[model samples]
Target: MAEGRLQRELNRRNPFETPEQEAVLNLLRTGDLILNRFGRLFGEHNITDSQYNVLKILRDEGQPMPSLGIAGRMVQVVPAITGLIDRLEAKELVVRRRCVQDRRVVYVEITPLGTKLLAELDQPVLALHKQMVGKLSQPEVKQLSRLLEKAREVFSQ
Candidate 1:
């Protein structure tokens, strides 16, 4: 008898085919919205989401990493790690070095500039995350994370 929040938001004339369909749609919609917020924030600093992710991964590792390794760690699978690295290289944020023993392997290392940029963004990024889920209680946040992780397991199959 009652319309769901998502249904109303979507301005749907009909109900979702099933609860599963509704839940998945809601998750996707929410994820896109949250991602857009981060995109704006990243744009303010002239960085794309993928670039930020790459820098963060390299910074966290505390050393140079293989280009493929960086690609694997990316949240979304980026098809052209080379182009991404090239841009960062042009920005002088990161450097690509050929391996000494294995000439075929190119390693990417974050420069001081990249480290500084990430440090500058750390607080803003954290604040944005908090702002997005500010309405949720601590327990609710934990529950939501668990539920998301559980849903993600579907990918393993």
Candidate 2:
């Protein structure tokens, strides 16, 4: 039998123990490759991807949103969300507002600066996504999405 792409890349002396193991490794490798590309791009803009995501969620809401509410939409943990907000606040891209009646509830709103930053990033981000997926045909892209979604379903079980 011919060696597979991953076996050649890993320079493995033996085949993967199972097809599931091979698939998992491939997914992880691909995720790391894609993440590195985006990390560099976001770093150039002086913002991490996590920070950018916070701004995007705020901007999309078009109003102040409770901090926890924003965090719910993100992959970040609740505690980490507070840190993300703090950094953004330091950058003057967002402001934290305490609810008038509920001191414990903090709301995060994107500042004009935040909105501007996102606007500036819109084209470059889109271009990067296109460049990343450029090799895949439309149908291939759809298939890949479906496969990823199906993989995610496994976690729900």
Candidate 3:
């Protein structure tokens, strides 16, 4: 069999040290490529991927969430959440409020403006998802997702 597309694309004359190494590298590369495309889309809307993710989390929760809870769900470091919230607050996309019961706790909520922006993005985001994996048959996509989930199970052990 010929070298994989990634090996060829990287111009690597030597084979990967192991199948595990190759699989990990492929996963990272694919993730990076997809993220880059998403970044471009978000850029056009004047937000970063992190910001979009934060908003999405809040929207999905259907209620104000603690700042730490939102940060825990994001790929970003906990400290970085402050800056992200700051930027979102500046845009009036999100607002931060002190938890009435606990002054030390801050809650973040998506504003009407943020919800509106997310609504505007719904169609484009869906289109991009289709564009990304539309070639895969539904079953194939399901299989891929299952396989990835199974692979992640190792981390739980």
lDDT of 1 by residue, 17-62 (tens): 8899989999999999999999999999998888898999999999
What lDDT score goes with residue 129 in model 1?
Answer: 97
lDDT, residue 71, model 3: 82
Q: lDDT (0-100) at residue 75 of candidate 2?
A: 82
lDDT of prediction 3: 0.93
Cα lDDT tens digits for candidate 2, 1-157? 6777999998999998888998999889988888889999999999998998898898889999998899899887799998899999999999998999999999898998999999999999999888888999999989999999988997899
TM-score of 2: 0.94
The sequence of per-residue lDDT tens digits that candidate 3 reaches over residues 16-52 is 8888999999999988988999999999999999999
- Residue 76, candidate 1: Cα error in Å is 3.7
C-alpha local distance difference test of each model? 0.93, 0.91, 0.93
Model 3, stretches more than 4 Å misplaced? none
Candidate 1 lDDT trough over 10 residues, lowest sum: 71-80
